[model samples]
Target: MATSRLLRTSAAFLAATALLISGCSSGSSSPDDEASPGLTTEAGAQRPAEEATLAPLPASTPAGLRSYYDQKLTWHACGNGFQCATMKAPLDYSRPEAGDIKLAVARRKATGPGSRLGSLLVNPGGPGGSAIDYLEQYAPQPASIRARYDMAAMDPRGVDHSQPIECLSNKQMDRYTETDQTPDSPAEVNKLTTAFRDFAKGCASRSGKLLSHVSTVEAARDMDMLRAVLGDKKLNFVAASYGTFLGATYAGLYPSRVGRMVLDGAMNPELDSRTTNIEQTAGFDTAFTAFAKDCIKRKNCPLGTKSTQDAGEQLSALFKKLDAHPAATGEDRKLTESLAGTGVIAALYDQRAWPLLRDYLAQAKAGNGRGLLAFSDSYYERSPNGSYSNQMYANPAVNCLDLPPAFTSPEQVRAALPSFRKASPVFGENFAWAALNCAYWPVKPTGTAHRIEAKGAAPILVVGTTRDPATPYIWAKALASQLSSATLLTYDGDGHTAYGRGSTCIDNTINAYLLDGTVPPKHKVCK
Candidate 1:
């Protein structure tokens, strides 16, 4: 799964979740911005140049793993009055005694008025997103699932609060976000490359040791460890966005261990970085078209109403203007075209933010950028105090290690511009350049694009939102088609994921499966 799922998926958590689905608003800044510090070149010097492919899992725990799987977990009160526990797993599963990573696990016991089923592990995407944070903040599963099953999650290795990955500091991030992804000239392209290079160097310096092991394959192995420690006879899960990829890996590795699983807003394991980036650009384009179609009906549509084509053209023009001369926001910071574009893209994740996007665009059109900046800030997980979460850092770290670069150089991206522009005239240039990010990654990728058949598994439910900007709906179709015994549930709507977003039909269908192990009929379509 590529980054379009976003750590704002973290930022998008109740954090951006509020901004995204609920249209939650936040205030912008006005203090003087500081210059970014020089990139550190000494952090991950000892990491192997060749990325470490995950050591193969043994058949039946390989005698060396008996202790990890048989260990008892002692749960205690943690965040939000829920139970939390710590477990240990080998850093390199192949070498059991070399070192161990501490895995953080949390759970809310079943609030049952009926018999409790096994635990249901939930991951709200972002290979970098904190699963624990999502569970405590907004818990996407229905209340009935909470009542019938112990709701739980684990922060995947190298993610927030679980030996988190650290890359650039806040000041550098400020510069990084403003660094133009869609460069129009050679100098601009060089600047963009430097930003990505520096960002990569920083992650390498700080997290070389952890970078190679943060691949989804290793994370899926961690999940199996969690499942065993939780005392579940079989794994029952609801994994969304990138989490779908993680869960699918688990099913493929341990098919008989799968119980009822829901893979919502899935990623096609078959797509390489270039294809993922191109498809994601198209996904955002589809979403923008949906937003534009609705915007034209509103009285204050800022992009104007001649047509979706005109709206895109106007939006593109505004981006160009911001690129040349940034707009001032409520904060002392100026909103460069890159930030403004990010703000626009952030809002595109959930159509609920479209009216706000229209209002913010109107503000930007009139020379104010606070609202748009706020959206960008939320997307980047930037704080009002000018601090940042490890999201931007960990996101790149995990993405780089998980897959090979989408484009190896600027020339490659340039060659692909036509296809991207054709995919999304408004957002294509940005996604195209965004694909260039992994090109300069410090660590090699441990994974590759392929299918996850999970052949002997029981029926798995896959949900797709027709107009989802991230994890395009077709991906859900592809994943469902790939998995044997998979059922595709279509949400003919706009947004990222579908289960808990006011869709009674989606919620009920998924709820039935989670609570009763009853998968919805194959290819079920819900509006």
Candidate 2:
């Protein structure tokens, strides 16, 4: 299975449960006028030179707030023994009273033998991945753990049933995901640039006004509302990958309401888009090197090289070959450069997937492209029947909303390529281009690359896996250092997220914290 599936499927499962709840009104300022300190508008327009002042929490939050929160929900029974609902929130937080936008929420009450600890909100990264789906599918907490908490998830604004931001039709998505992320020449580069522009245009046309407000900050605030509605005095959360950023933002904004939060596969909110993309590219390179090292020791390694560098060169050559002459899958699909690259990226997320990747590479080299294409399809979440979850579309929408575009244009990307490549010789160029997805985003960012000094927050735990591919390990370090009261938990492993991907030490440490409100000592490492 692809690593994306591991994360995306879990995310989708969480989103599935959090089915439509409510909407929030846009604040007084237009989306473009919102104070985003370190980001530029979609048109590359600079934000007005004014500092953003944090709005004070509502004075003496209404005594009937919980009742109001419940009354706003429209509930329905969903699959997997859960209830789903939709609720309204402002598209812009600045004008909470002006209008309302809908958000999807779901919950499965714990069937427990332990005292209820309150609602435990879960988010599985992607900035766009469905939190409801993760809760429904992958939340394998012990019945003892489940018995003590009501598990809940919400599809962030502009995702899934929460007034979804659709950028393209299914067919267009197929074409878009297949567009080469890595360009080998001027022609290929132009094709890549055009693909990105077309994607942005598609989003603008399809999503219209909705695209302007699907940001992390907005989602974080929505989470606070969810917390209020659930009648929990504090927010307890398990967030992976980009979800970590969301969770961290919540802690920053509502530290007094934090119960127990676990940020797995954390992203550094302090990094600029360029730095983030470059660092992630390097992370993939590190992961690939780990894979290559392991591959060389195995007798059946397809690349059949003694050195990791040689293995990368061979894989690059294979990609070049695939680009020039796409391989036909028996099912009438062809393996293009993008598909091959996707396959490679998918495998890098988990060490267990390495053997599968090797086998697929071997089969592809023999002119049977089915295996590799299957891996790519899995990463894209494209089922054989041609249906796809809204992950890719959601990923870009939320990601673009969270930070400034990595580059303003192809020229800027080209100028930065050498530095990116120097950071990760094998994967940098491709990731540098992939970061362009936000360059033409329909919504302007309302947040920026600033250290989230979550001052006044209770002790928050930040988790990191040394070999995590999607979120580099250093991010956990950076996030912990930035947060005023963060404690870092390290898991020396190879995977996307550490808590549940199977590390007894990691799981136990986190579970103990969640259960007792105890933070691991700073710089705690779990082997």
Candidate 3:
């Protein structure tokens, strides 16, 4: 049920107890802004063509895909020192000629005082999050790393600016997100399931042909194609959250082609959907415990300073109160139990947001839900004007396509509730119900839970944040153990990911690997 947004960038909003899944307006480089990769300046001025960086595809490349591999990209001078391009990927790899879909690509070339190493493709989690938005807005890479490698990103298929999947309308999404997750009545459960059904149907109706093709396997294939077009002999990547899964899949499929890859906030591909939800629930509980311990040390802590256990009871009580009598935000939207939970969950992604969560809880306790509602809005990526980016739509599309549902019926969910509650007393019920989302998916899963060894791949760095909420530290350990050449880098800290979040040790270790190919010893721990 947890949305594993890499480096814990922005928290993705999940509706109450259903496994669910950013918003950015769709963007493509304008025709007039297009330029050849090495021939145009960031200011759009003409320059002499430099030697192409594109590495030729292997001689064994299939004839059907040779044209795709041979395709040239014309970069555009996008704002803020980045170039953009559009690349075509087959809609269905099995039948290359069926059609092609356009993938939006963006890069900031290496600002060198050092010789350029190569392009380093980055993904900021969310099988649904937009890489372009991550590259442009988050830009977590340090200048030292940026100076040596072109930081590249592509919006994977069925994601933003890449034939994005569309689901509920803005208003529908609002209602859907606000729906009761901890259904106390059968009628409430039916309503919650109905919302999921409508969401799935909307995706099938609008996204249609693409829904069946947006699996992580296909996205990984797209990455390989991108690596070739960028002219890198091997794929150099830094992927977080769900991106870790994408990166591992690439290494598994094209082991010899992996280069200087880092998988942070790693996902255990071995776990089935049910186990992932349960473990993630426990992870969130761990994060909440950390938050409660910190809160108890502060004056006027909303949950009271009695004890962490007392704090959980108080928070649970608040949720129960909101469930019966919603709190009014300044805006038309009120803070219901689901949104209140989401708002709290959103802040847990990063320690930086703890103060905000404290303030929001204080406000909620005062019967003013404005702050919590705003946090929930941010989590949903709901614009003030009301339109949504395609992230929510694509999250389930990719998830359901990649793995089977956690629970196919309410009976199963009810049966599993006790175990979920044992995992997380506060958030377990919602997360358990959230896992039911894929059950209503239009397409049957194309993937199954399996370990990814990625044998023959270069040494891959696997990072784990001990208290990562969405992707637990245990998952990182599991992933590292599964990958043949992986070096486990443990951050005995809080937050969703380790690097680029003020940890000098984590940052230096990764920078050394990405810059000088210096792999750390096995099971290195950073505080």
- lDDT of each candidate versus the true structure: 0.78, 0.73, 0.81
Best by lDDT: 3
Q: Best TM-score goes to which candidate?
A: 1
> Each model's TM-score, in the order given?
0.91, 0.88, 0.90
Model 3 CA deviation exceeding 4 Å by range: 1-8, 11-59
Compared with the true structure, model 1 gives a TM-score of: 0.91
* Ranked by lDDT, top first: 3, 1, 2
In the range 289-341, model 3's lDDT, one tens digit per residue, is 99999999888899999999999999999999999999999788899999999
Candidate 2: tens digits of C-alpha lDDT, residues 1-527: 11121233223322322222122221212111111223342123233344333332552555434433565566678987899998777765665565678888999887877778999998878766777766787764656568888989999988777877776777777777778777778998788778777877888898887777888777887888888787788898988888888888787777787788888888777776776776677678878988999898988898876899988888888888887888888976688877888878876766667777898898888777887787677676677788777677777777777678888888998888787777677776777787776777767876677667667777788987777777877778777877778888877767677766556667777888887887877656765
Name the lDDT of candidate 3: 0.81
Off by over 4 Å in 1: 1-59
Kindly indicate the candidate among 2 and 3 with the higher lDDT: 3
